[model samples]
Target: MAKARSASQAASRSKQARKPNSLKSAKTEHARPDESEGTVPLELQQKCLTIFRDALRPSADDVAVLQEVKGHLYNRDFAAAFAKEEYLRVYASRWSPSRALGYVRVLADIQDHLLPDDELARLGQSDQESLEIVCLGGGAGAEVIALGGWWSVVTRSMPKIALQARFVDIAAWNDTVETLHKQCVTAPEISKYASAAAREANRPMLSGDAFSCHFHQQDVLDWPENVVHTVITPTTKLVTLFFTLNELYSASIPKTQHLLSQLTAALPANGFLLVVDSPGSYSTVSINGAERKYPMQWLLDHTLLSDSQQKAGIETAARWEKVVSDESRWFRLPLGLEYPIELENMRYQMHLYRRLATKGDG
Candidate 1:
């Protein structure tokens, strides 16, 4: 059984609410630079919250649907929870900004610890002269926004580098994904309900750039090797599973393993794999005749760090260099942050691996 009422559940509870299409409160203050450690720029964070709050206004009926969606997800009923557009809208409005900021924090940490300037610049030197990222289960735009936020900062001196982001999930998230992409790349239209001061403050979170995003609505496990190749290309620099790996494992371990293997094999040397998930034993799997629970981080370590697959008679040539591993990292909400709904600070475990050059490679 999965951990009931995980972080997502906590994120769904709004600390404040108002009539539809309005902020939870009119008071907004600037964030302290020292607080976020500069991972998420204060202005960008405020803009991100504003964009989501303005774009996905939830009505009374939508709030009811949000509660239903939360219950279904808590029960691990993903099919039912994400089956409707209303569910996705309410979910995104309620939770995405905080999750997106969480990813911004994680990506910045990776840059500081794992990737240096020259190495990150090389990501755009592929045949197409572009940087590519694949996000598994990234439908709600957390990964998309994170990439945009991070890229915006890193590419200030290298403005010509283009980014191509692909979001893969079972739900139809194209609309939401595009909406976020647009909001990040362009100045958001000031909401009429916004106060005059807010209208003056509204602007693009990130300056315009050559960023393109595409959403693929398919079961990642069902993606054949050929399909995987199309998505995770040689130009790919990053593949992220932000709070998504456990759900994949719970869906089907064999298939999730297959997908991971495919992704690893498809990535170019020096490409990175980032896995973020809720901590503790939230995933249940059956072994022999009984079901057992294992921590998501442990499972990933066993599969990617150790040669347990070879020991189990499964032949694989995957070689990865562990760059970062943490069992629990906290991303607290920035102080003075205000939104239509209160956002929960995220505590997640993360693993980052760099694909090593295999034998016979140049």
Candidate 2:
């Protein structure tokens, strides 16, 4: 009899888990059937490709550097892979577009579901206010491009709210990020010999006032606790991990945990955290002196969903509510898209979580 009762309870819990959240469902119901999922617009995609091409230009040793970068990446030596400008250029040309497309699509799907109506309204009312996005390991500019593309589309129907993107990474991506930012928002620099018509046709996709970005170079784990917390400020509304979390885990699990905890503490209630990473088992750990591979998604779930011993044996309330979860999603490059280097499709896992109320809030 007891076994039967336990089984029945488990079944009930499963059913409840399968049910959709009311708020998310409401947004879905009102959305046009075609709007359920979005593709990165071809024009936006082309604009990003042009920005990358214009910024990076062409190099004679591109093929060689590409091979070297891939080798370093395969061995998990990220610092070495991104040491030189040539390597960074090779990487951006090869991978940035597809990753940007992935971010654009994912953000579009979640935009309507992100903020509570009241908070969104308050933000929209203040012209001086901007939506704050902090991107971890955003050095490559994939998240930057993605956010710019996504913001351009969203402002059409919603209020013309400004956007600020803060990129935190260990690499020396300041120069690259700045170049991309400038090219994305300002008109292209015309040649001295160019005709007036040519200059007139070289405008940027979005106006200079639409989007702003900044880059910080520091390893999150090495930073002091207070200093680490400073990266995420009171106004930070959204935080993103774009192909970044797995690398963090691979580097140092303990430090990554501390960084995550600090980030969690800093987010205001209703603030969102978005994580996207390769769906493969690239993150590894040693089990009893033998190295073993573990899926990145599993480790994240364990850290965020499971209770921690650091709570001093007290059962604390859950800190986050999962807003969107997809184990595997594909973003394919649109046909006829042209770029200097081959761009491959991306298969990523994503999770969006909203911070829950904690102690000290009235």
Highest TM-score model number = 1
RMSD in angstroms, candidate 1?
5.5
Per-candidate total of colliding backbone pairs: 0, 0
Model 1 C-alpha lDDT per residue in residues 1-362, reported as the tens digit of each score: 01111223322223221122223443323334433536677666666677776667744456678788878867657667777887878877776777777787888888854457776567545445676788887888677777787777777676667778898887778898888888777777756798988977765655655688998877776887888888888878889887777767766778777777787679888889998776663678789989988887777766776642475677656577788888866666655566766556566778899888877543
Estimated TM-score for each candidate: 0.82, 0.81
Model 2 agreement with the true structure over 244-332: per-residue lDDT tens digits: 67667866777777777777788888788899866663567777899878787777777776653347768777777788988776665
lDDT of the structure predicted as candidate 2: 0.69
lDDT of each: 0.70, 0.69
- What's model 2's lDDT at 112? 78
RMSD of each: 5.5, 11.5
- Candidate 2 residue 167 C-alpha distance from true site, Å: 0.3
Candidate topping lDDT: 1
Off by over 4 Å in 1: 1-37, 58-61, 112-115, 120-128, 191-203, 206-209, 308-318, 360-362
Task: Report the C-alpha displacement of residue 326, candidate 1, in angstroms.
Answer: 0.8
What is candidate 1's CA lDDT for residue 148? 84
